[model samples]
Target: MNKPVNRHPFPGTPKRVGRVGAGRGFSAANSNTRISLPGRTLDVSAFAAPASHARPGNLGLNSDRLRAQMIQRLRNQGIQDERVLDAMMAVPRHVFVDEGLASRAYEDAALPIGQGQTISQPWVVARMISAMCENRVPVKVLEVGAGCGYQAAVLAQFVKEVHAVERIRGLYELARGHLRELKLQGRVRLSFGDGMLGLPNTAPFDAIVVAAAGIKIPQALLDQLAVGGRLIAPEGGAAQRLILIERTGPAAWHREELESVRFVPLRAGTQS
Candidate 1:
């Protein structure tokens, strides 16, 4: 394995808020973003204007219906955190995907986002955040599989800070741009690297979320979690399960199964 790229400060300040403020909307700043996900650049801020009810973003999906459907799906799947629910609903999901796919953004399936990765659906995102803490502990969080940065943005409302890692270049740049569009880039930092190794500088995270699934939880992530910090991830390959692990002692951790989950595999390595 190679040394991972560190999570650097946002390329520039508001003096340079990337694609969103400039109106290009997440276009590559220096060069074209090279995300490893299996999709193309999202056509953001170009969809037909949304109806009056949900006027902020015109990404096709009705905001209320999307929120309700997500909540219902989560409840059926056993996600029960009001804070998480509110945050999930508050963040516009349609804005996260390409305009072409905006109509299906609220669906339960994970869709492709360039490279070989898919942004885990809203339900899964909410489930992971809800599973992190039952009560409002309000601690720092470690997020893997930055994907399109939607999950990290969802985590920002409930947690103090979110340190997220993305292995793909295009997706990473797009995610950073997404955060800035939502004014969340300040709350969440993006690391262009492998999710398997985890972000160590912001280690001992009060909560850890592996947006991508692996055969088992990555051991390095376990070692980096703060005691009492809850790590929620979808583990296993063919038969994936959402596992919740809590650090009990300096090196001891407790595990519990939440539910069955399927997610993109947590891939290894970083951009060269």
Candidate 2:
């Protein structure tokens, strides 16, 4: 994956927490490059690669030092699941952010991605995945927020199939292009519509992750989950935290508190 050069000449605390909801369509300026390990470059182009793009090294995509810094940042943020850590380490984050900010791809904070939306922090991505997984590698997964497709990429590693639903058209295509370049077109499928409505056709998901927090877990999502499926998400605003929902018996379910977290509020209806 591409490594970000960190220049902390002057540092300031994060101004805020939480995600910006998936509202309407928005455009993203994609300036992506391939990622690499130590000295080897990994080609990350998927369906999103643009023919007009420059060679990644010229675009600042890969470097041993940058990759290490990214791994360190995720580690410091407490992303400890070995599988998740490895996946996060292997996938290129720069491909999912604005090209101008690709250099900061591995930072432990969220960044804007137009459309009043933001790509989630890497740690947050790991945490939600780890929580729903229950220490087991996943099989089939459903992701409610496909912003930039970063989180979906993370889930695609362990799971057999990841059906990610995004509410906005532009972001959906943005993620689709990026995932394609990553060669993940076969592993991750992007659906553009009301995520709150859930993907009924592909229901019975082994694991469900809602990247955007909601006042309450949507009934549609719950109904779609397979028995024993796990759903993890942030459940409140101002005082957000992670909740794990598990399917027990037919129409029976259980809930567990996993961790405190903040994400954009889940919205209803569809975008035009």
Candidate 3:
């Protein structure tokens, strides 16, 4: 396996703030940013727009009712975290998919979002988020494979900031547009870069969630995790299992294997 790419710093003086509660607690920086990272900087401000709460037109199914059913099914499937359930309820999964497939958005299945990528199933997203937050609600989170940005949006509601990276340009732009329309671009920063090379400049993340399955956990991602941070990803092939890795100490981590799962391969580098 190849080494993950090195990440540069956010283009400004980023204060090292610890965990913070939800609500309007996270705010964007307005002043000029300082350039610290080596590669190109992703200007989150470019994707900024006020999120809209307007209801969509009838699309053969009632979104609210379907979303409710999805949440209930998640509950039945053992998703006990109330915050995770609420976030799933709050986000309109249909808005993250193509118009043709919007009707089946809440069917508890993964839908393709072009570029050979698929939005993660609701159950998996909830389970992963719940596990990562099992110890504590993270203040800063990193998401590998931004897909339609649905997971990032869901996570943004629970965490302070979300750094979502996507290796495919098409998927990255698609996610960026969806997130921008949902007005979640503020809290979810989208990047079109390699996923294996976890963003190092934004190191010591409170939580890291990988949407795709890898042969093994990337050491670079583990190195970037804070002491008390948690990282969850689908590991193994042919017989894949969800693995939860918690950074217990500076050089120590505790690993736990959860339920079985099937996910797209986690590829390295960018596809522009």
Which structure among the candidates has the greatest TM-score?
Answer: 3
Clash count list over all predictions:
13, 16, 4
Pull out the clashing pairs in model 3.
Answer: 8-37, 9-37, 11-34, 12-34
> Any idea what lDDT model 1 has?
0.61
The models' CA-based lDDT, in order, is 0.61, 0.63, 0.66
lDDT of 2 by residue, 106-218 (tens): 76656655544456666556666766775455678988767678888877876888998877666677778878889998999888878777789888888888755666777
Supply candidate 2's per-residue lDDT for 237. Answer: 54
Error of 2 at 66 (Å): 2.3
1 versus 3: better TM-score goes to: 3
What candidate 1 gets wrong by more than 4 Å, as runs, is: 1-61
Over 1-272, each residue of candidate 3 has an lDDT whose tens digit, in order, gives 21111111123322221222111111111111111123432111001111232334555458889999999998765677888888889998888766666788898665654434455667667777888888477899998777557888998877888998877666677778778888888889888777778789888799998766667777788787899898877666566556778777777787776655554456666766
What lDDT is reached at residue 201 by model 2?
Answer: 88
| Weakest 10 consecutive residues of candidate 1 by summed lDDT | 18-27
